[model samples]
Target: MSDRPSPGPDVVVVGAGAVGATIAYTALVRGSARRVALHDIDAAKLEAEVLDISHGLSFTPRGSIVGSDDVEVCRGARVVVVTAGAKQKPGQTRMDLAGSTVALVRTLMPRLLEVAPDATYVMVTNPVDVVTTAALRLTGLPSRQLFGSGTVLDSSRLRHAISRRVGVAVQNVHAYVVGEHGDTEFPLWSSASLGGVPVRDWSRGHGGRLDEAELAEIADEVVHAAYRIIAGKGATNYAVALACCQIVESVLRDERRVLPVSTLLEGEYGVSGVCLSVPTVVGADGAVERLAVPMSDDEQHRLRLSAASIRATLEAVGD
Candidate 1:
């Protein structure tokens, strides 16, 4: 195993569960970082996960993987991705898992800061927006330095659903799922485009492919995608791990990519004091700036409603 030495790991994944392990593995394979460290309270699980991934090092890029129950493993990390939290169950919403997850983050974030104060922290736990808000309050870190994985995964799911419905490549379907990454999340259909054409205007002679009914169905699918996955499997990991890895890449490489990540809103979209997903520029410094993308009246209202939902949860959790 690689020992923690000077010029510590490029990325540190906190937690050694399926999601955490996958983030570590993905970062290594994508060359997102040279040294990836993992930490979990479960010593046995951490060791096994580290060994399992380390065994396949030859198949991946030249990188080092390490793990420990000690938070010291996270020291000097350029980016720390937290995927440790209570697992969501089949019938429960993300909010249902919030209280326990927030409590865990409350205890975990301080220790993380002690080891890697300057590291950009990404919260990948459930009800991530709330957990992120709590972390921000608990750590007093700049919003740019601490944020949530947010709806980056939700946006991907939205784009995939749109692409499938419109028979286009998912990459070309530019859409975003904004607001809370939970039941209240909604799509920014006003700005969505498919193959360089507005989604609302897409037509193949007869009628629009993304009519009102189809759009509603697609939105529902995107919002409930996680529940469906969890009902099938015990947890949803791979897609979210990839999404978290994208955020890590943007940070470690200073890519300055625009992503719909959750950040604390300070009057943007008339919402403040809550963390929710909005299109923001992410780079080495973290969520640097949020874009004031145009939204239709209905879309704006929906965003406000989403904000309200998150605010209520924050109040309930006493954050």
Candidate 2:
């Protein structure tokens, strides 16, 4: 028999809960990774999830899925997506879970990093900005190699809202939600567009014109969409899992897709030392570059406010 060791998994999802399991399934089905490993503390849940997904392998692109309670399952992963944290209850803000989530990350991140030090880490636990900042401070990995799945989902929500209002395909609605992923997040309407037309200039055809007031309402809905989903269902998994898979695919495929992901800012837009979502280029190296997208002065101010909000949570968690 050959003595060569088998290569590690292409992706490692830490946490086998709703979000994590969905991410693992999405990655495999999308062909983002050929082998995905799931690591969680709960052995029964992990085992059940692995088996359930494994049963569906015949329908998906050729891939292998494995799970274990040990962090060793994460060893040699090229990309590690973290979704482990306290689940958010209805009426609770993402910041409300910060203390417990950040604490969990503090204890969990080092173990994952120890096994997959070279893996590009994507933090998805909410208050994601705070958790990401804590992870960066604790691990000291370069910012590009580690970032939060920030406003990527939020931006998708924003685009979807705009699409419905304008009666266009969501894929054609190009907009972004930047800043914190929580209550402080806001849309970059100044740069928003629908089918190459600036959003503000778009006139109604079948749908209503997106005027200033309607835009404001849309932004509010995007910010609270998660709460509405959480109130109805215990958690949001589908879209978020898809978003995480998009990041994983971009990294493994080196797609260099532009996404609004959270990374530590070093004087970008005059905000420094805080993790918040801004339009950034994500690829094999992780959040490789931050884009200086044009933003109205008001939008810039709001982004700073979002940064302050995340910084407060970081301090509260002793980061």
Candidate 3:
């Protein structure tokens, strides 16, 4: 490891796979953190990733990028993103990988905390809510300091699909995918908007209207886009890499931005104990508070079920 003088790595990524490498590149390119470290169990892969990242240093903002097979690189890290876990196979849901991921974290989290006990952890593995809940039990840190990269991507997918269908810029389209990051996830269509105008109002103004069926179709696409991508490319990485960058930036820069990350609920929306995706304000302090947006009764019911689903997986794989 190239020792940079004091104030060590601002970000350390565990797992040197496609997602991890992409996250390292994106974070440096975006200047999310000045010093970023990449660590993995495979020495050869970590060396290759380090060299690749080193080669591109001249093109990015002035920052140090290092990779290692040792978890020691994580020492003094401000944020450690855990993306090391088994990839989801074709025809599988994120929930299906729970056992393997749980096993992976059970081994890695303790080692990680040993070196970087103060770092905020960003859980990116599949079965994110379950892994996050398990990590919480293992680390016993403040709930705000660790969270899953939950349905944030699902919400992004929804916005993209809505933008495409409505011929609006993606940024102008506002939507959310709440509850689980898996099969039970649902779109908050009741309050979804286009530049602050409800979708219904926006569509009506444009001389068309989005009915329940159309919105549901878009939501369905958001929920299952991962399976399609994994089937096509063996793993889904690019969009998620960008999502992880956004998360790292939020903490590194202390941007108190609201995002839909998963944190253990203590009675939000009448749910508790389990960690599930919900709107949260994240900054240097990590997930600060979860926003309680209005949800229809059916939406609340489904959210509860989503929490229960993750809770069941957590119970099956004891902490």
Most lDDT-accurate candidate: 2
Which prediction has the highest TM-score against the true structure?
A: 2
Instruction: Please list the residue runs of candidate 1 whose C-alpha ends up more than 4 Å from where it truly belongs after superposition.
Output: 1-5, 205-208
The TM-score measured for candidate 1 stands at 0.97
Q: Please list the C-alpha lDDT of all candidates, in the order they appear.
A: 0.91, 0.92, 0.89
Q: After TM-score superposition, what is the CA distance of residue 1 in candidate 2 from its true location, in Å?
A: 2.7
Candidate order by lDDT, decreasing, is 2, 1, 3
- Against the true structure, candidate 1 has what lDDT? 0.91
> For model 2, what is the alpha-carbon lDDT of residue 26?
95
Question: What are the per-residue Cα lDDT tens digits for candidate 2 across 53-86?
Answer: 9999999999999999999999999999999999
lDDT (Cα, tens digit) per residue for candidate 1, span 155-262: 999999887776788889899999999999999999999878899899966234678899999999999988898899888888988898899999988999999999
Off by over 4 Å in 3: 1-5
Ranked candidates (TM-score, high to low): 2, 1, 3
On lDDT, the stronger of 2 and 3 is 2
Error at 2, model 1, angstroms: 17
Candidate with more favorable, higher lDDT: 1 or 3 = 1
Task: Work out how many backbone clashes candidate 1 has.
Answer: 0
